[model samples]
Target: MPEPAWRNEGTEPDYRFTLANERTFLAWIRTALALLAGGVLLHQFATELDPRIVVTVLSAGLGVVAAVLSVVSYTRWRANEIAIRQGRPLPFSWVLPALAAVCLLTSAVLVVLLLIA
Candidate 1:
């Protein structure tokens, strides 16, 4: 693949920082995969969850989140790389709070489902 133009614009960052960024990117990817797996497992093995449609929607939501996260992870990594190379403060992102909110909402829904079941 052709190298990105932005990569050529800035001095190379320290190897340790670059590797750390890569690791963070990988962690995001792993989280996305875990969410996807949870969704599939919920749909396939959660036969007892009430309201089949709710379960289906929740399962699908997880898949969607996973897909979004996959893309977001790459973009965030690129942004961080660029910032690092340019000697700028790392760019702020909403991913953490957003992820926390999603987890909280998912858990609350599951709790409600369990109570109802």
Candidate 2:
């Protein structure tokens, strides 16, 4: 495939930085997959949880978060690559905190469901 125009704009970054950025991107992808799997499993196997609507909504929320994370991860990886090549400070993102909040909410909801069951 042809290289992106942005890749030609900046000096080539060190291979180590490039590889590390790739690894980070893969890690984010893995996390997103895991969340998606959790959603599917919850929907399929957690038949005992009451308030089926709430469970369904939570499962769908996880899938949505996974989808958003997958997109965000790629964008973050590209931005990081550009910054590294240009010798600029990495851009900050709210992705981590937002992900944490979602995780905490999911855990709390699960705990409540378990308690109620």
Model 1 accuracy (lDDT, Cα)? 0.95
Question: How many steric clashes between backbone atoms does each model show?
Answer: 0, 0
Tens digits of lDDT, candidate 2, 78-112: 99999999999999989999999999999999999
Q: List the residue pairs that clash in candidate 1.
A: none
Quote the positional error of residue 7 for candidate 1 in Å. 1.2
lDDT by residue for model 1 (1-117), tens: 998899897898889999999999999999999999999999998889999899999999999999999999999999999999999999999999999999999889989999999
Distance from true location, Cα of 115 in model 2, Å? 0.8
Q: Model 2 scores what on Cα lDDT?
A: 0.96
Lowest summed lDDT window (length 10), candidate 2:
3-12
Using alpha carbons, what is the TM-score of model 1? Answer: 0.98
